[model samples]
Target: MEESNFTEKDISTVETSILSSVEASTVIIISVTWFDTRLQSIQWFGEMIMLIFITGLSIGENKVADKGKC
Candidate 1:
């Protein structure tokens, strides 16, 4: 098996991708909440935001692992 090596630039790219995904998710969540009347938008937004944060943290941890820093 061939092992691929990633440079610092690769790690930065991953971080940027994760952040962009989070931003996209936020926009989707907002649009959904705005379109729903019965649903509690605040609660949904908060939960989704928390999920996004957790996902970002996990991605960051993975990046650290890839860098052999943890």
Candidate 2:
């Protein structure tokens, strides 16, 4: 049998990919909900907007940190 050890680089790559996937998923969910009649309320709309805004800022912060590390 063979065993493998994950390096720091591999971990970083996985984290970045996971973060990106989450962001994309959030966008899709928000879009679908936006068009769904069940979510037709100003309060629900605002919450979605806030969630997206926060996610955007978090992604932006990661990018900045990556730049600083380079």
Candidate 3:
């Protein structure tokens, strides 16, 4: 069995990827919901939640980058 060795750079890469993916997904979701009036009632709530999550991810990514861990 081989053991996986993960470094801070690797972790930073993963976090960055996740942050980008989530940001993109949130944009797509908002755009999709924008054109569909039927889902308007829940759109704001969903987008708010996604924005909060994206914010947290951005904060974490920024901290990692600032700390020179990547």
Task: Return the top candidate by lDDT.
Answer: 1
Better of 1 and 3 by lDDT: 1
TM-score of each: 0.42, 0.44, 0.45
Give the alpha carbon lDDT tens digit for every residue of 10-46 in model 3.
4556466676767776676776788653446576677
**Candidate lDDT (C-alpha), each:** 0.70, 0.67, 0.69
Clash pairs, candidate 1, are none
Better of 1 and 3 by TM-score: 3
CA displacement after TM-score superposition, residue 1 of candidate 2 (Å): 58
Candidate 2 lDDT by residue in tens digits, 1-70: 8777855554465356556666765766777778653445875667577667656766877888899998
lDDT score, candidate 2? 0.67
TM-score of 1: 0.42
Candidate 1 lDDT tens digits, 16-58: 6667767866776677688653547786687678677768777
List runs of model 1 lying over 4 Å from the truth.
Answer: 1-39
